[model samples]
Each structure stands twice: as structure tokens, then as C-alpha cells.
Target chain A: MFLAVTGFAILRLHSLFAVVMLSGVYSLIAAAMFVALDAVDVAFTEAAVGAGISTVLMVGALSLTKQREKIPVHTPLLPMVVVLVTGAALIYGTFDMPNFGDPDAPANRYLVDRYIQESPKEIGIPNIVTSVLASYRGFDTLGEVTVIFTAGVAVLMLIGGARRRRRPDSRAGPEATRE
Target chain B: MTFVLAHLNYWVVVVLMMIGLYIVVSRGNLIKKIVGLNIFQTSVFLLYISLAKVAGGTAPIADERFTVYANPLPHVLILTAIVVGVATTSLGLALVVRIREAYGTIEEDEIDLQDDEE
Candidate 1:
């Protein structure tokens, strides 16, 4: 219900502001769902990331462009077909899934329980999930952070190529006023 | 926690996750795509927090006789994920801004057509 409504808001809206606001609503609901699951910490993070910073950045992006479409739009049929097929395959695969939260599930028998029990002693943190993500899964986290850093660098390179104008008539700079 | 973890809500969250992921994958509008991405990320947060709960555990606060509080680990990990999500969204939006500035279009399909024209 929440997702459907938000998706409708985002997809139906032509205005960038409306789309961004709808996205905020989507995030806020997600955060609430997280809290309902007893994940207070996750809720906090969702609010900060999904509802706050991302919305601001989207609005900023909107400021740089026309909010309304200036060209004819075609429905993306190829991607839609591909996604639908993949989703069907995924649903078929899930028939083999262990029922949700089944105690005898293979995952429960694995290291997650062990980490929850021993992390307090080994890492001495109140949050076992942190110990797993930072200490045990430190290598993966390092990789993730590196990916973010590399992405930031890549974007800088792409957008910062602004000094040498590709064309003399590309007058979209801050100083250029449309008469 | 008792009823929520046991039944109904769990399935709802799962459905919400799938819908979010679907929108993110299927949308062509860059901003709509980002909104979908937010939904996808939040669904994972729900999954993590749900898994972090203990059946009869207390909240993880320093109180006497409440040694077996629900694990605080999921919360901390989610906090980090949240920060990462925010940064990614902002970067995505910033890229959209630059794309608009350079190409004067925001729709992915339109941008591709423009590239073909060039």
C-alpha cells in the first residue's frame, strides 16, 4: 500500500518538486516500517539518508533543469520485458526458500547466532551488527567505502570538464542569461 | 515485537520490498529511479531490523536484570547504511544536475536520443 502510493506519486508527477516530495514520503514510511520491526537504529539511519539528504540533493538537481518534460516520452518496453521475466524467474526460485524465520533454516544454524553471542566479548560493542559489519566483515565494508570514493572522483571528472567549452553556443553557464 | 515478528507484518514488508525494487528497476525517469532506489534500500533496513529482534528480550539499555536485551548490532549497522544511502542519493542527484546543465534533458530515454543525434 505504502509503496504503491509512493510509486504512483513519483511516476504520475511531471513536476520535479512533487516527485522529490513523494520520494520523501516513501522514505519516511520505510523508516516507520523499520521502527515497527524493532530496528530503532535502522529507523534513525533511514530518516537521515532517505528523507533528509537525498531529497535536498534531488531538489538541487531539479534547480539545474526544466521540471516539465520538453520532449515526447516513450514507454521503456524492452527494460520492462526483461524485468518481468527476471521477476518471474526469481519468484520461481523462491519456491525453494525455507519458510520465513524458520528456526531450522540453514542461516540460523550458521555464524549469525555465534556472532550475536560472542561479539560482545570479542569486539566489546553494544551493537553486534556493527561488530559483524566493521570487524568481521571489515574487508567488504572497505570495498564499499572505496567504491563510494571512486564514484565521487568519477563524477568530479565528468562534470568538472566544464572549463573547455565543447561548443561556443553551449551558453548554459551561470553567467549566461537567456534573452 | 511479539505479534509483529511472528506473523502478517513480515509478509507485508517483503511485498513492500519487492514493489520498491521493481519501481527502481523499471522506471526511466532519473528522479523516479532514485525514489525507487530509496524504497529498495529501506526494505533492506526493515529486513535487518526484523532479524535483530529477540523474542522476549528487553531494549538494549543499561538496566539491572535485563541482560538479554535485543541486540543493538542491527541499529548500528543500519546507521552506517543510512549515511551511505544519503551520500549515494545526493551524488546521483548532483550527477542529474550536471547532466541537465550539459545536455538540457533529464529523461534517460531523451538523453540517449540526444546522444544519437550528436
Candidate 2:
């Protein structure tokens, strides 16, 4: 119910500011849903990243652009049709997926058992999620961190570098004056 | 009826995904499109977490008493994905900021029109 309402609100709203606020609300609701699904770590990260960091970054971006969306000129029919067809195909695909919480599901059959049985001894961590994320998948986690680092660099280059070179003469400078 | 109820979460996920896709496709505002992309990514996150669940099992914590643990692999994978999502979103937004500075408008049609004139 919350998800439906939030998704609809995001669709209906045109004010970019209000939409960003609603997206934060959506993320919080999603974090709560994650908690219900027994993914505490995921919930924590979602709350921090989705609700916190992204909202802040979005507001920062919003400050640099128009606050309201201009009315769309083109008809939305084509996009609606495309979305409907794609959604229908995804629903059809889901029919073959194993039922919720089926222990014998293919995803749970092989490596999961070993992780459950031996992670405690192998990694000496009580939380198997952390153990798997940090130890068993250390290389993957490193790559993820690298991705984040690269993103930071990219954002800095895109937003920061431009401001620096755009105005070299002013004493007050562009950054301090813009804000 | 049983089949529908059994996969209710998936259906909800699908609904959310379509909504996101619609926003991305129809909205002219770049920031709104990014918001939609976030919603779409989130629905995928829910799908993965839902699949990782095991009936009557606790979180994947190693302990003597609890034998059944939800699959930890999906949780691990989604954690990485969520981080990646944030990175992509921020980068996209930064690009939007730059677009506004260069073109003097964030609306897609307006930017295209400005480009045509130049």
C-alpha cells in the first residue's frame, strides 16, 4: 500500500522539489520493507544511501536547475504502450520463478549451504552476510569501492572543474557567489 | 488464487518497475528521470531480497541454535548493487547540473531546441 501510494505520487507530481522529497519518503519506506524481509544490513545501507545521501545530492542538483518541470510537449501514449508491453513480459517471466521462501530453490541449493555451514569457522564472523560480503567476496567489494571512488572523481570533475575555470578574475569567486 | 497470492510480492515489484520505466520514458526533466531510475533500481533490490528469504528462518547469522538461514549471497550482491546505484544517480545528477549551466535549461525539448539553433 505504501509503495503504491509513493510510486503514484512520484508519477503525478511535477514540482521537482516535491518529487525529490517524495523519493526520499519512498526510500525510507523501502528501507522498512527491507527490514521486514530480514535484510538488516541492506536496510541500513538503503536508509543511509537512498534516503540520506541521494536526497542531499539531488537537492544540491536541484539548486542548480529550475525548481518546476515544464509541461511535457509530446504525447505520452507511446511511452505508456511501451511500458505496458515490457511490464507484461516481465510478469510472464516471473511465472517460472520459484515460490517465495522455497528452501530447495536453485538459488539456495549449493554455495549457500557451505556459507551457512562453514563461514563461522572460515571467517570467524557471526554475521554471515558480512562475512560473505567482506571476506568471500572481498575482491568484488573492492571493485564496488573503486566504482564509488570513480564516481566521486567524475562528479568533482564535472561540477567542480567547470566552476574553477569558468571565473578566474573575480575576487569573491564563482563558488562563494553562486551559493 | 494461490498462485497469485504466492507471488504477490513479485507482482508488486513489477508494478513499481513499470511506474519507474514510465517516468523515465515520459518525463522531460532529467532529474525526474533519475528519480524514476532510482525507483526502478529499488524494485529490483526488493526482488533480490525477497528471493533470498527462507521460510521460518532468521537473518544469515552464524549460530548454534538456528539451522535455517536466508541466502546471504543475494544480500551481498544487492549491497554492492545499491552502492553502484547511488554512484550512477549522483553522476547523472552532476551531469544534469552541467547541462543546466551550458544550455540554460533542464527540459529536454528546450535543450534540443537550443542545440538546433546553435
Candidate 3:
């Protein structure tokens, strides 16, 4: 219920600061939901990443730009129609999916049994999530880590690194010309 | 009635996904768009986690007393995804900051207008 309310608030609110704050609240709520669903690790990550780091980064970005959204000149009707159609289609599609927590579901039926059954003998880890992530899917985790590294480098190159060099000269030129 | 009841969680998730999609499509503010994107990504994470659940199962830890365990694969996959999400978000915000520096405004329409004039 709170998640829905947060999403709605984010949708209706125009103040960028308020939106940022609400989105953080939304993430925290999402983390709590993850906990209820028995995904403690996911909840931890969501709280740390979604609520913590992302909020801080967004605030940093906000500091560089205007806070209030300009009143939109275009009508929102077209977007609204598109969203409703897409949403309806998605809901219809979910009718074919397995029930919420069916053990016999295809997602649960496949290699999961092997992971659950043999992982203790093979990897000898108490936590299956940690064992699989670190051993069974180590390469994928490495790739993900590399992707994060690349993103950090890319962000540094894009804004943090280049902006300093350009700030002293080009900053005045653009705003002056715009005015 | 059982079907609807059983799938209520999915329905709520779908609604959240649509709200995210709506924000992405309608909002022109670059930062707001990124927030929308985050919401969309989070909904996807929810869908996967929900799919991984087992009725009356504990977290995927090996315990002699607890035989039923939630699927660990999805949890592992989503861990990676959450990391990727944060990385993408930071990069996106970085781009937005640079956009503001280059264009003098973060509004998409205004940025386009500025580009046309230039």
C-alpha cells in the first residue's frame, strides 16, 4: 500500500527535491517488502544501493540543476493512453505465469533442484545464495563487477573529470549566450 | 476468485511497473526520468524475487531443520542486477549533471529547443 502511494506521489509531485526524497522512501519500502518475501540479501542491497547511494547521487545531480520542474507545455493525454494500453497488456500476460509461490513452477523446477541438493556437497557453504553467487556463478559476478567499474570510470570521464577543465572558461560563455 | 487472490501480488507489481513506465514517458525532466527508470528496474527485481519464492520456505540457507528454501538463483541474479542498477543510476546522474552544464537546462523540451537554435 505504501509502495503504491509512494509511486503515486512521485508521479504527481513536480518538485525535484520532493520527488528524490519520495523515491528514497519508495526504495526503503521496497527493501522491507523484499524482507517479507524472504530475500534478506536483496533487502539489504536495496536499502544500501536504492535508498542510500542512489539518493545521494541524485542529490548531487540536483545541486547542479534547477529544482522546480517547468510546467509542461505538451498535453499528457498521449502518454497516458500509451501507458494504459501497455499496462493492460502486461496484466493480461501475467495470467499465464505460475502462481506466486508454486514449487512446481518452471522457474523452480529446473536446475534449482540441483543447486539446492548438490550445492552443500560441492561447495560446502551454509548459505546457498552466497555459494552460488561466489562459486557457481563467479564469472557472471565478475562481469557485473567489471560493468560497475566501467560505469564509475564513465561517470568520472563524463562529468567529474571533464567539468573541471571546462568550467573556468566555457561556463560563462554558455549562460551569457543563453541570456 | 482463487486465481485473482493467488496472483494479487503480481497485479500490484504490474501496476507499479505501469506507474514507472508512465513517469518515464510523460516526465520531461531528466532527473525525474532517471527516477522513473529506477522505479521500473525495481519493479522488475520484485517480479523476479516473487517468482523465486516457495510457499512456507525460509531463506536459501542450508539448515537440517529447515528443508524448504527459497530459490537462490534469482537472489544471486538480482544481487548482480541491484549492483548494475546503482552503477547505471550514478552514470545517468553524471550525464544529467553534464547535460545541465552543456545545455543550461535539464528540461528535455528546452534542451531540444536550445539544440535547434544552435
Best by DockQ: 3
Off by over 4 Å in 3: A167-179
Lowest summed-lDDT stretch of 10 residues in model 2 chain B? B97-106
List each candidate's DockQ score. Answer: 0.34, 0.76, 0.84
Candidate 3 residue B106 C-alpha distance from true site, Å: 0.3
Instruction: In model 3, state the lDDT of residue A38.
Output: 90
lDDT sort, best first: 2, 3, 1
- Residue lDDT tens for model 1, B1-118: 6444354444555555565665666555676677767776776676666655655554444334555555565666676677777767767776776676677777887788899999
- Each candidate's interface RMSD: 4.1, 1.6, 0.9
Q: Tell me the tens digit of each residue's lDDT in model 1 across A35-145.
A: 665566666667776788777777766766667643335565765676567656655555455544454555445555566567778888766556767888788678778
Best of the two (1, 2) by TM-score? 2
Ranking of candidates on TM-score, top first? 2, 3, 1
- Quickly count the clashes in candidate 1: 2
- The Cα error of candidate 2 at residue A97, in Å, is 0.7
* Best candidate, TM-score: 2
| CAPRI class assigned to model 3 | high
How do the candidates rank by DockQ, highest first?
3, 2, 1
